[model samples]
Target chain A: MAEATTRERILGAADRLFGSHGFRGTSLRALTREAGVNLAAVHYHFGSKHELLVATLSRHIDAINAARIAQLDALEAAHPNGDIPPLDLLNALVRPAFAFRHASPENAEVVQRLSALLHSEPLEIVHPLMEGLFSRVMQRFAAALERALPDLEPEEVYLRIQITIGAMVSALAGRHPPDLADAPGLDEEERIDHLVHFLAAGFSAKPLNGADS
Target chain B: MAEATTRERILGAADRLFGSHGFRGTSLRALTREAGVNLAAVHYHFGSKHELLVATLSRHIDAINAARIAQLDALEAAHPNGDIPPLDLLNALVRPAFAFRHASPENAEVVQRLSALLHSEPLEIVHPLMEGLFSRVMQRFAAALERALPDLEPEEVYLRIQITIGAMVSALAGRHPPDLADAPGLDEEERIDHLVHFLAAGFSAKPLNGADS
Candidate 1:
C-alpha cells in the first residue's frame, strides 16, 4: 500500500515535469525532489528515468485502456444482434480517456502537459512504452468489430477505427490550442456527449450513399 | 526580389531548426547563423524567434493548405454525380504533405524534425506562433466543407471532420505508436490509397443510429 502511494507520488511529479518540459527537458533529480522522495526511493520504485516514464504512463494508461475495452465489450453485449450501435461503442471507447485527461476539474494543467507529450510527433523512446498497452486495447475493439461486421476486411475496419481514434484524440488533446474560444455550445459534459454521438454515427453509418451503392 | 529571397531563406533556416529542436529548445543565434545572415537580417526578416515560427509555419503550412484546397476542388469538380469519393479526397488531403515530407528524401532528418514540431505538446512560446495562420486556414476549409456537406449540421460536420483530421494528423504526424506494423500493405502509395478510401467512406457515411431519432 505504501509502495503504491510512492508510485503515485513519483507519477505525479513525472507527469508535471514531462508535460512542463518536453521529455528531453525533464530530469530524474527534479522529479524525485518534486515527489518529496529521495533518489533511492525513486530508483527502488522505478529504476531509471526511462523506467519511471513507462511506469508513469502504465499506471494510468493501462487502467484507461481497460475501461475503454470493458466499456466497448459491454456495449456490444448490450446490443448483441449482430447490428452494432456506433455511438455507444465510440463513446465507450473515448470516455475513459477524456475522463482520465480531465480527472481533476480544478487543474487541467497536468492533462494539457500529457496532451502535449501525446500530440508531439512519435518518438522511439515512447513507442514501446505505449505499444503493448494501447495496441491490445485497440485489438480487442477490433476483434469485437470483426465479430459484428464479419464481411469487412480487417484492414478496412482497422483503418476506419484508426481514423475515428485520430479525430477523437485531437478533439480531446487540444493542449496547444485556439483556446476553445470558438467552441461555444459544448460544455465538458456536452463535448463528451456530442463526441460520442458524432463518432457513433460516423462509424455506424455505412459509407456515404453506402446503402444505395 | 532580394528581400523576398532573404525572407524565404530565413524561413527555411527557422523551419529546419525549430522542426528539429522545438520552440523552447531552439535559439535565435543558431537561426541567424544558419541563415548565414547577421542579427540585423534576422530582426529585419522576422523581428523575433516567436514571429519567426509564425512566418515559417505560415509559409509551409499555407502551401500545404492551399494544395489541399486546390486538390479537393479539382477532384470534386471531376466527380459531380456521386459522393466525392473518400479515398480520392483523402489523397487530396494527405498527398501534398506526403510529398512535402518526402521531398528531401536524402534528408530524412528534416521530415523527422518538422513532424516533431507540429505534434509538439505545450510550448508557451510556440502556441501563439501559428494561431493566426491556423485559424485562417481552418476557416477556409470549414467554409468549403459547409458547401460540400450541406445536409449535415455545421457543427456535426465540423466535429466529424476534426476526427478525420485527427486520425490523418496522427498518422502523418506519427505522434504516437500507430498500428502500421500490422497494417502491412501501407507502403507509400498503398497507404495513401487506403487512407483516402477509408476516410472518404468514413466522412461520407451517416451518423450511427441516426441522431434524428
Candidate 2:
C-alpha cells in the first residue's frame, strides 16, 4: 500500500469524529489532534469544518454511486432487450452501499451516522448535495422499475421507490433491521439479500385498488 | 387561555432550538434566553440540559403512545373477532404519530427533527429511552400482526415489522418521503393512508423462499 496523503488522513479523522461525536460535538481542536495536523493545515486544506464534512461525505458517495451505476449498466447489458427485475435494480442500488460496512466498518459507521444529519439538516444544506449525488441514479432506477412493473401506476411506483429508499437507508445506517432480540440474525450478505427480497416483493405487490379509497 | 407555566415555556423553547440546532448545537444559555427565563430558573426547573431533553421527548412519546394504544384498542373492540385487516392494524400504529404534524405544525416539526436524533444517537443513549417507550407497544402490534398473517415465520414477521417501523420513522421524521420535486403531493390524511397501504402490501406479500439464498 502507498502512503496516505495529508488530505486522506484529515478526512479519515473527521469521518470517525463526526460519526462518533456528531457534527456539533466534534470540534476543530479535537479533529486536528486526531488528524495529527494543526488548525492551519485544516484551514489550508478544507477551508472550514463544514467544507471538510461535505468533502468526507462526497468522497464516500462518489464511490457508492459509481458502483451502483456500474451494477446497473452491467445488469442492463446482460439483459439487453429485456426488462431487469425491480429487485435486481434495487439490489444494484443498495449492494454497493451495504458493502461499505464490510469494506471499512469504521468509516461505514461514520457514514451511517452522518446519514442522520443528511435527513435532519435544513433542506438547503442537504438538498443540493443529495440531488447532485442521487437524483439521477434514483430516476434511472425508477424508470427501470416502471418498465419492469408495467401495471403499477407511476404515482404508486414513486411511493414504493420512496419507501424502498427509506428501507435502504435504514439498512445502510444500521438503524432498524436485523436487531430484534429474539429474531435470528443474518450475516451481511444475507441481510442485503433479504432486504433486496423484501423490497422487491414490496415493489412488485399488486396495485392498491378502490378498496383502500 | 391560561398563561403557560415557566417549565412548559422552557420545554417549548428547548424543543424548537434543539430541533433546529440539534442537541449539541443548542446551548443552555441560548435555551434560557429563548425560553424567556433566567439561568437559575432553568437550573431549578430542569436540573440539567439532558433532563430537559428527556422531558421534552418523553412528553411527546407518552402522548403518541397513548394515542396508538387507544386506536389499537378501539380497532380491536370494533372488530371483536379478530377480523381486522393488516392495514387497519398498521393504520392504528402510524396514524396518531403522523397526526402530530397536522395537530401542531411547530411542535410536530420539533418532534420530527428530534426523531433524527433518536435514530442517529448512540444506541446507549437511545436504546433505553426507546425501549421504555415503544417495546410493549411494538410487542402488542407484533402479536396482532402474527394473528393477522399466520403463515409468516416469526423471524420474517419480525423482519417485516422492523422494516415497517423504519418506513414509519422516515415518514414521521418528515425526511425522504415528501420532498420529491416532481411527485404529486398528498395531504396529511392521504399520506397516512398511502403509507398504510404500502406497508400493508409489503407486509402481506408472501414470504421469500430459498431462491434468494
Candidate 3:
C-alpha cells in the first residue's frame, strides 16, 4: 500500500527495460528515465549497470531459491531417511517458480521475461552469474534428486535436472510452438501440474542403453 | 573445397554476429566488416538486416526440417497404420537437429548459438518468423505425436511437445546447471540418446490426476 523505495523502483525499471531490451541493448540513461531516478541516484545505489542487473536478478532468484530450500527442508524432515518421492522433490524445485505468478500479474510477466532473457544472454554473462547465484541450490537439488532416484547414476540425475530446468524455463517464457488453432490456454496451476508430471516421468525413466530399440 | 560466394560469406557473418551480439545489437556496418564485404554487398544479397537474418536462419532450419519430414515420412510409411512407436516418432523429431553437429564442429556451434539467440529475441521478431518458417513442420510433428500417444489429449500432446522442444533447444544451446565437479561430459550421440529417452518417457507419462499424491 506504501510507495516503493528508490532502490525498488530502480530494480523494477531494470527488470522491465532489461527484459525488453536485453542487458547489452539497455542504456543507463534509459534505465534511469524509466525508474524516474537520476544517474546520480543510480550510481549511489547500484554502482553500475552490471551490478544493477545482478541486484535485479538476485532479488527474484534469491526469493525463489529460498522458497525451494524451505520446501526441500520440510520434505526432508518429514521423510527423515531422505526417501522423498521424485514427484514431491520435483514439485519443491518447480512450484516456487510458478508461484511467482501469484504476485501481481505484471510483476510475474516481467520476471518471466527477464528470466528467459537471462538464458539467452551470452555465455560469458550467463555462465558466471548462474554459477555464482545458483550453484548451491542447484547442487542441493541434484543431491536430493539423486537420493530420490537411487537407481539412476549421478550424471544421469544431473542431466535430467538440466533438462527439467530447460522445460521450466521454456514454460516460464511461454515458448510454445507457433500457431496451434486450438492450443489450450492452461491456467497457472494446470501449467505447473503438467510441467511437474512431465519432469517426474523423465526423472523416473530407465537408464539409456546404447542399443535402445 | 570451392571458395564461398559473396552471399555465402555475408550469410556466414550474419550468423556469427547475430548469434553473439543478438539481432538488435548487431549493426549493419559491423556485419559488413565481419564478412569482409561492403554494405552494398549485404543489401544487394539480402535487402536488409532482417532479411539477412531470415536467409541465415533459413539455410539451416530448412535443411533440418527437411530431414525431420523425411524421417517422419519413412517412419509413417513403415508403420502404415499410424501405429508408429512414440520413441521412433520422437526420434524423427529430435535426431535431425542434433545431426547439425556432424557438419563440422565450428558450423555446428554457430547454428546452435544462433538458435539460442533466436529464442531470446523479442516475440514480435521470433513469433512471425517461427510461424512463417516452422508452422507446417511443427503441426505435422504434433499430429504425428498425437497419433503416437492415443491415450493423451491433443492439448496434452501439444504441451508435452512444447516442453520437449524446450528441452531440445536448451540442450542445443548447451545450457546446463553450473559447477558439477564431475558432471559427465556427454558426447554428441550420447546427448541425443539421453534426450530422446527423457522425452519419450515424458510423452508417454500417464495423464495427470487432480489428486496425484
Candidate 4:
C-alpha cells in the first residue's frame, strides 16, 4: 500500500507539472519536488521522463479510450443489424472525453494543457506519444461511421472523422480568443449537444456535385 | 526597391523556419542565415522576433482575411434583402484560405505550420498574436451566420463557427498518422468544396431540442 501511494504521488505530480510546464519544459527535479518524493521513487516507478509522460497521459486517455470503445460496443450490440444513426456514433466518439472532463474540473485543465502541448510540440515528441493512442479507436469509429453513412465513401468518412477530431480537440482545449467578449458559457451537457448536432449534420451532408477532383 | 527585396526575403525565411522549427525552436541566427541577411538587417526591419512573426503571419493572413471580408461584402450586396444562403456564407468564410493555399503550394505548408504553431503554443505567445487577427472576421461571420440562420441563437452561431475554424485548421495542418496508409489525397479544390459543404450543413443545423443548459 505504501509503495502504491508513492507511485500515485509521482503520477499526480507528473500530471500537474506536465500539464502546466509541458513535456520539455518540466524537469524531473521539479517533478520530484512537487510530488514530495526523491529521484529514487520516480525512477523506481517510471523509468524515464518520457515514460513518465506516457504514464501520466495514459492515466486519463486510457480510461477515455476504453469508455469510447465500450460505448461503441453497446451501440453496435443495440443495433445488431448495423443500422445505428450517425448522431449516436458521434456521441460515442465525443461524449466520453467530455464526461471525463466533467467528472472533475481539474481534469479539464490538465487534459486541455496536455492536448495543447501535444498539438504544439514538435513532431518527434508528438508522433511517438500519439501513435497508438488514437489509431485503434479512430479506426473503429471510422469503420462504424462508414457503415452508418452508406452513401458516403469510406475515404470521405475518414476525412470527416479527422475534421471532427479537430473540432473536438479545439473545443476541449477551450482556448478561445479573449476578445470574443460574449462567447457562450454553456455547461458540459449543452456543449456536448451542440457539438453532436453540428457534427451529425456535417456527417450527414451529401457529397457535393463534382466534388471529386 | 532593394529594401523591399530584403524585407520580402526575411519574411519568406521567417515563414519557412517558423513553420518547420516553431517559434521557440527557430533562432534569430538561423532565420538571418536562411534569409542571407545580417543581424542588423533583421533588427532594422522587424525590430524583434515577436514582431517578425506577426509581420510574417500578416503577410499572408492579411490577404486572406481581406479576401474573406470582400467575399462577404459581395455576397451581402448580391442578396440586398439579407436573404443569403448559409452555404454561400460558409463559402465566403472558408474559400479565401483555400484560394490562398492553392495560389502556391509553398503557402500551404507555411500556413499549415504557422497554424499548428499558433494552436499549440503557450497562451501568452498565442493570445496577443491572435487577439485582433481573427476577431473582426469571426465576428463578421458570426453575425452573418446569425442573420442567415435566424432560428438558432447568436451564441449557437458563434459556437459552430469556432468549431468550423477548428476543422479548417486541422485540415490545413495535414498531419495525419503515417499508418493511415489509405488516407485520401484530395486536391485543394475538392478539399475546399467538401469542407464548405460540411460546414454549411453544420451551420444550418437546427438548435437541438432542450439544448439550452
RMSD values, in order shown:
5.8, 3.1, 3.4, 3.5
What 10-residue stretch in candidate 3 chain A is worst by lDDT?
A111-120
Clashing pairs in 4: none
Best by the DockQ measure: 3
Clashes of each: 14, 0, 0, 0
Per-residue lDDT of candidate 2, residues B22-94 (tens digit): 6656889988898888887777998877778878887887788889899889888888887678888888888
TM-scores of the candidates, chain A only: 0.74, 0.86, 0.85, 0.86
The TM-score measured for candidate 1 stands at 0.72
lDDT of 3 by residue, A160-203 (tens): 88899878887887755675556656666787889899998988
Q: What does candidate 4's lDDT look like per residue over B1-213, in tens digits?
A: 335588888888887787777776788999989888897788898888868887877788889999999999999999888878988888887788878887866656566665555544566777777777888887787778888888887667778887888788777766443234466566566767788888888888878758344
Ordering by DockQ: 3, 4, 2, 1
Stretches > 4 Å off in candidate 4: A1-10, A21-29, A36-55, A121-129, A175-179, A209-213, B1-9, B37-51, B119-125, B175-181, B209-213
Show model 1 residue runs off by greater than 4 Å: A1-8, A16-33, A38-51, A73-88, A106-123, A175-181, A201-213, B1-58, B72-94, B106-127, B175-181, B205-213
Model 3 C-alpha lDDT per residue in residues B119-171, reported as the tens digit of each score: 55666787778787788888998888888788877777888888998898878
What lDDT tens digits, residue by residue, belong to model 1 across residues A12-119? Answer: 787777766656567777778888788778789777775776666666677778888878777777777755655556667788878877775423334334434543
How far residue B201's Cα lies from its native spot in candidate 1, in Å, is 4.0
Best by lDDT: 3
**CAPRI-style class, candidate 3:** medium
lDDT of 1 by residue, B175-213 (tens): 344563467633555555555555565566554333453
